[model samples]
Target: MSSSLVVQDLGFAWPDGDRVFDSLSFTVGPGRTGLVGLNGSGKSTLLRLIAGVLRPASGTVHTAGSLGYLRQDLTLDTQMPVDELLGIADTRRALQAIERGETDVAHFTAVGDDWDVDERARAVLDRLGLTHVDLDRRIGQVSGGEAILLGLAAQLVRRPEVLLLDEPTNNLDRAARTRLYEAVAAWPGVLLVVSHDRALLELVDQIAELRDGEIRFFGGGFSDYEAAVEAEQETAERLVRVAEADVRRQRRELIDARTKLDRRVRYGQKMNDTKREPKIVMGNRKRAAQVSAGKHKTMHQEKLEQARERLVEAEEAVREDDTIRVDLPATEVPAGRTVLTVHARLAHVGHQVDLLVRGPERIGLVGANGAGKSTLLRTVTGELAPAEGSVDAAVPLRYLPQRLDLLDDRLTIVENVARVAPDATPNQIRSRLARFLFRGTRADQVAGTLSGGERFRATLAALLLAEPAPQLLLLDEPTNNLDLTSVRQLSQALEAYRGALVVASHDEPFLESIGITRRVTLPT
Candidate 1:
C-alpha cells in the first residue's frame, strides 16, 4: 500500500463562530514531516481531518493507509492498567488480519497468526521507551506522560501506513524527546506530527507551516524555514515601499488627467463666440466638436479607472505581504540589588540542591516531567513558599504561570487588562493592548473567548501595565502556544529587556537565544 496523504482546499469552522481551518492544504509522504503553527491555528484540526475524526467543511482528504493518530485527547480511566490501554493483545490480532487481508474495514476478530501480533506489539512497546511498563500494570497508576507512551505503543503495534500525532512530546522530557526523534527517524511510513519541540522538527524531512490561514511548504528543515522567512520579510519590506510609491504616482496621474478633461469640457461649452462661414458650416463644426468632446471624456474616464485599479493592486500587495511585528513594550525597571536568595532551599521532590540569585540574573529552570521545575519556580516566586528553608525576595515580582490563572475569564480583553490595573485609562489600555497585537476592535473581545496564544499575550500585556515593571519576571512555559515566529519575537523582546529574566521552558534554543547564561537546574 502507498504511504502518503493528500489534503486539498480544506476548511473548517466552529458552530460558535470561530474559524478553525481556513483553506488549509498540504501533502505528505512516507517520511518524517513536522507540522508547526501557533496553538488554535488549526494544526491539530488538520491532523484530525486527515485522521477522519473530523470532516472538512469544504474539501477533500485522501489517505492511503490504515491510519493511527495520537491526539492529546486520549481518555484512559485512571484505574485501568496501562497494558489494557495499550491493547497489546488486540493490536496483535489486528495486524495479523491485515497481513492476510483477512479482516474487513468494519470489524476485527482473532482467528490465526495471533501469536505474531503479540510479538509485534511487544517490540513496538519496547521501542516507545516503555520497556519497563509491565504489561499487567494499570495505567491509572502511571503519570500522564506514561499513559501517552502506552497509547503510542498501541498505535505503533498496528504498523500503520500513516500516523498523525499532535503535541506528542508535550509531557515528555529531554531524554524521551530524543528517543522519539530516533524512533521516527528510522520508521518507514508516512508521518505527520504537530509539536512545539524544535529538536523534533530538525529530524523531519519537510516542514509545513500554518500561518495566516494558509499552508506554505519549505523543502528544508526548521533552520531553513527560519532563514527563508527572514529573506521573505526583507523582500516584503522592499516591495511594500515600491508599491507605496507606485500608488501615489498613479493617483497623481489620475488627478492630472481629470483636470485636463474638465478644462476641455469648459472650453467646448463656451465655444460659438467666433463668427462661422455659414449656418451649415457652423452646425457641422458644432456637431464635430461635440463628438470629439464625447470621445475624449470616455477615454479619459477609462484611463482614470485603469490607474485606480493599479493603486488597488499595489495596496493589496502591501497589506497582504507585510511582515509580522513581534515587538514587546518592556519598561526598564529599577530593580533592587537582590532579586531572590534561596538558602539551602530543598525541592519538594528531593533533587537536593540550593538555589541563590543576586541582582538581575537571567536564569532558566529545566527538568523532565515529574521533576520539581514548577515547584521550584513557585518557591522562587513566593507562591508555594519554602517549606523547610529561608527564602528572600528583595524586589517586586510577577509570575507568569504555565496555566494562566491571572486573566479574568468573563471580562473582555480590554476590561480584563483595565480591571487588573484600575489606574490606567481606557485610552492607555487601548494603546497597551495594541502592542500585543490586540488592536482596535479586538480589545473588546471576551478574554475567555481568545485562543491560547492570544490569551497568553493578553496576560503579558497586563503585566507590562504595572506601574513599575516587576524588577523580576518569572515565566512558566511561555512558548507553549506561541509559533516559532512569535517565539523569536518574544526572544527579541526579552533580549532587549533590562530586568531579571527567569524562564521555565522545554525550549532549549529559546532559552539559549534569550541570553540565559546561568541555570538553576530543578531536580528530577
Candidate 2:
C-alpha cells in the first residue's frame, strides 16, 4: 500500500472552551478528497493543523509528503509591481537552476536561461488563468477574485505533493470557480478541499463528513455520499425507537415484581402476629418475609441498571437534536401582476443597476467581485436609495441581511421576536417562536451566543411575527456559512413560503433549491 497522510487517536480542545475533536483518526492517500461539515465544526481548524499552522493538543498528524495550504488570508503588496513580486528573468533562471540541482553558472546559462525562465513563468500564469494579466501591474489594484487566482499560481509554482484548500471558491464567479476546480483536479498530487460548491464535490473521489467534531467517511461522489447518509440516519432512527420500547417494557416488569413482593411480605407479617402459636411458626414467617424483601431490593437494583443502559444505547443510536430548526412564514403577495418596479438610471454608488419584481417573482442577481450586488440588495430592501434609478416595492418588505444584524444581540431569542412586533403579546410571540424550534429555555436563551443557523432562525422568528409582514422577502447569502442540513431546511421553508423570495447567494445548489425563476447577470 502507498504511504498516505494519517492521524491516530487525535484529541483536541480549545483551551477556552469545549473539545472539538476526540480520538479522531483518518487516512488519506493520493486522491481527490472532499472535507464537509457544519459551520464551526473544525474543518478549517483541521486544515490548518494539517498545514502545520496549528499544533494538535494530543496524538499526531503524520504525512509522507510536503503539504501546501490555501487559507482565507489574502494579502497583496499594492506598492510593489508584479515583476518585483515574481522576480526578473535572471532571478527566475537562478531559482530554476537551483531547483534542478545545477550550480555552475556557465552550464545554467548555456541553454539561453532568459528564454527558459520566461516560458516557465508564462506557463504557470496560463495554467492559473492569468495569462492576460499585465505582469507589471500592482497586485493592489486587482480584485479579490484575481488575487485568489494569483495565490493559486504561487502554490502551483511550488509543486507541493499535498494541497489543502479552505473555501477556495468564496467571492468568486462561476468562471473563476471552474478554473480553480480544474487546476486542483489536474494537479498530480493529493488534494483535500473544503468547499460548498456542488460542482467541486463532483470532482472529488470521496467525502469526509464532520459533525460534532467526529468524522465519518463516505465513499464516492456527492450523490452516493448523500444516499449513504440518508440510509444511516434511517437506521439510527430505528435504533432509537427500539431502545425506547425496551426501556418501557423493563420498567413495567420491575413495577409488577415490587407489587407481588409487597403483598407476600404483608401476608406473612399479619399471619405470624395473629397465630402467636409457637416460636417455630413465628420464626418461619419472619424468615419468609426477609427473603421476599431481599428479592424486591435485587429487582429494584436491576431495573435501575437497565434504565441507565437503555439511555446510553439510545444515545449511541443518534446524538442530540443538534439540527437547528429554520422555518419562516412570509407575507401574502399583492394581487397585481407587477408588484415592484425599478426605473432605469444610475444606481447607488453611481452605477446603472436597475431591477423589477412582478407578482411574486424570485430573482437572483449574480456578479463578479465589486460589481455592486450588495449595493443593489440594500437598494431593493430600502436600506439604500439608488443614485439615479428608483425601486418600487408595493408593500412592506422584510429583509434578512447577510449577517442577520437586525436581531438584537443582548436579548433572548424570544425577546427579540417580541421586540420586532411590539404590538404582539408575550404569549403570542413565544408561541410563534416555538414553531421555529425555540421553546422553553431555548426561547429564553440569549441570542448573542447562538450559532449562525440559530441566529438565522431567530431572525426568521422575528420576521414571521412582525406586523405587515414583507410581501417580499430579501435574503443575502443565506447559506454561505450554513451546514448542508441547515441549507436544506431553509430551502424547503422558502419553497413552501407563499411570499416572493429574492435571494442573493453564490451557492448554485441552494439557489436551485429555493426555486430561482429569473436571473440578472453582472459583468466581471
Candidate 3:
C-alpha cells in the first residue's frame, strides 16, 4: 500500500558527449518536493528518467507503485475530444452502450466497478476550473491553460501513487495557477515538480536542487531552502577566510624559516672559514647544520603546501551565483520623453485599447489566458496589423517575442550579436557579450547549442546590443521556460537597462522585481 521512488547511481549523457549526471542518486517519498536548478542542470532529465521516458546510461530507478507524469509542454491534438484525452473515453462509451440495452459482457467488463466514471470526470474538470468544457469538446476549442489543467486532471483521476509535473504553470493564468496550487497542496502521493514559479515552490514540503551533476535536498519550502542555503554559504565563506589566513601565515613562517636557516648557514660557514674548531669537529658540526637546515626547509614547505590545499578545498565549498553586469548609459530615458504610443483595435479578439509610454516607464501587460496578450504585443511590435489604429515608437525599439526566435540558429552567439550590431567589431561584441555572462568560448557557442536560459540571454543580448541602442523594449512572456536563476538574471539585466519596458508576463514576482510603473489589463 506504500509507494516511493528511488534512483541509484544514475548516469546519463547527451549524444554530443556532454555528460549531464554521473553517479547521481536521489529519492522521493510521499509529499510534494520541488526540483530546482539552473537551465542545463539536468532537472528535467532526471524527471524524465524517473518517468521512464528516458533511460539512464547506468544504474536503476525503482518505483513502488503506478507512476504518472505531466510534462510542461502539453501538445494535445486539437481535434481530440476532452474525454479521450483524459483516458476515460472507452469506459464512457461502454456505459452508453450498456444503457442502450446491448447487454454485452464486453461493455460491462469495460465499465468495471466504476459506474460513476462520467460524474467523476465532470467533478475533476470542475475542480480544475474547466466546468464549461464538456467531454465531447475538442481540445482546439480550449486555451493553453485549459490544456495544461486537462493534462493534470488526466493524471490526477488515475490516482497514481507517484506523480511528476514539469513547469505545469508555464502558460497558466492567475486563476489556473491557484487551482493547480490547491491540487499540489492536497497531493497524497509523491509529487516532484520542476519549476521556476516561486509561488508554486512555496507549496512544496521540501526542495531538491540539482547542481553540478549532483542532487542536494533541503527541508521545508522555498523560503526555508533559501535561508538554509544562505546560512551554509556564510559558513563556507568563513571557512574560506580561515583557510586563506592559514595559507598566508604558513607562507610567512616558511619565509622566516628560510631566512633563519640562511643566517645559520652563513654563521657556520664563517666558523669553518675561521677554523674556530678542530678540522674533524668542524666538519661533523657543518654536516649536522646542513642536515638540520634541509629538514627545516622541508617541513616549512610541506606546511605551506598543506595550507594551500586546505584553502582550495574551502574555496570549493562556496557556490557561484554570478549575475550579469552591464553599462548602458545610452539606453537612459529622460522624464516627459515620449517613448511609445499605442492606439490599436484588436478586432480579432474584439478589444480596443490605447496607451502611451513615456520616460523609463515599466508597463506590465496582464490578462486572463487566451485574452490576446501576445497578440497585443505582436501588434505593438509591428509584427501584426490591427484592424484600426497604429503603434509609434519615438526612439529605437526592440521586441523579444515569446518563442525567442530572434536569433539565427546557425550563427554563433558572437556572430548573432554582430549581425544586430553590424558596425561593432567582434572584439567589441565579445566584450559586451561578456556582460551577459557569455565570455570566451561561450561567446563563440552556436545559438542552437545554448540552453533555454542561455538562449534567452543571447537573444536579450542581441536586442539590447543592437545598433542605435533600443530606448524602448517589448518583451512577451520573457520568463516562460526560464529557470529561477535565469529569471533573476533577466531582472538584473533589465535593471541596468534604462529603456522603457513593456513586458507581458503572468509572473507577478518577476514583474514587481523589475519595478513596473503601470498595469494594462486586457478584457476577458
Candidate 2 versus the native: TM-score?
0.87
- Writing each residue's lDDT as its tens digit, candidate 2 over 179-269 gives 8878877878788888776778878989998877778888897778889877877888887787777778777877877788788877777
Give the alpha-carbon lDDT of every model: 0.72, 0.74, 0.91
Q: Which stretches of candidate 3 lie over 4 Å from their true place?
A: 422-431, 439-442
TM-score preference between candidates 2 and 3, better one: 3
lDDT (10s digit) by residue, model 1, range 1-524: 67789888888888887787666677788888888877677888788878888877888988887888998677888777554566564554465567787757532544244445555656776777777777667777777777777777777766788888887777666667666777778778998888777877888888988877888888677888778877876766676676667656766765776677677656644554454356677667667767876776677667667666765665554423212244333434444456677764555665554665665678888777778777777877767766577777676677888677788889998888786668889998888777677889989989888887677667777775665556678898887656665676566556656677788877787788888869776666
For model 1, what is the error of residue 432's alpha carbon versus the real structure, in angstroms, after optimal superposition?
2.9
In model 1, the Cα lDDT at residue 286 comes to 64
lDDT head-to-head 1 vs 2, winner? 2
Cα error, residue 449 of model 1, in Å, equals 2.9
Question: Pick by lDDT: which candidate is best?
Answer: 3
Candidate 1, residue 236: Cα displacement in angstroms equals 4.2
Q: Say which candidate scores most in TM-score.
A: 3
lDDT of 3 by residue, 1-524 (tens): 67899999999988999999889888889999999998889888888988888889999999889999998766899999999999999999999999989898999999999899999999999999999999999999998888999999999889899999999999898889899999999999899999999999999999998889998999999989999998999999999999999999999999999999899889888988998888999889889988998999999999999999999999999987568898888899998899888788875886887889999999999989978888888887777798898888899989998789999999999999988899999889999999998879989999888888889889989989998999999898988899988898899999999989998989888899999999999889
Candidate 1 backbone collisions, by pair: 78-140, 81-138, 81-139, 82-138, 82-139, 92-117
